[model samples]
Target: MPHIHVRHYPRNFTEEQLRAIDEAVTAAVTSTFATGEDTVSISLEPVTPEDWDSQVLAEIAARRDELIKAPGYWNES
Candidate 1:
């Protein structure tokens, strides 16, 4: 039940890059959760800098307690 979602700035990634990411994420998730490769899923979403505060920051703040690892950036505004 480990579904990974990555939100990042907009960019066009080639198929190789996408595949690499999926493989890397899958490996990490499997190692961390001791889960099988078949049970993991990954998705990436593009978030522009303009909407980072209202969208990403808000989400991080809202889910602070549940964050496995907090980011170095961001603060109350």
Candidate 2:
């Protein structure tokens, strides 16, 4: 089974947007993986508006010292 995870912000997305995303995922799997839409599993997660930006900021802050001190930490292949 092929699993696809789609994450979206909570505030601005509409039903049409969600439908489009689902369609796109189905199309992508069918085209690229040669899989039927029924076999493609999708999970959609929406983050709360208040928690989203704060979570991102916290992650950046936690990594800030390493980011500033060692460019290799971020640029490693």
Question: What is the C-alpha local distance difference test score of each model?
Answer: 0.92, 0.70
lDDT of 2 by residue, 26-70 (tens): 898889989788898888777676785466445655677654343
Q: List model 1 lDDT by residue over 23-47, tens digit each.
A: 9999999999999999999999999
Candidate 1 clash pair list: none
Instruction: Please list the residue runs of candidate 2 whose C-alpha ends up more than 4 Å from where it truly belongs after superposition.
Output: 48-77
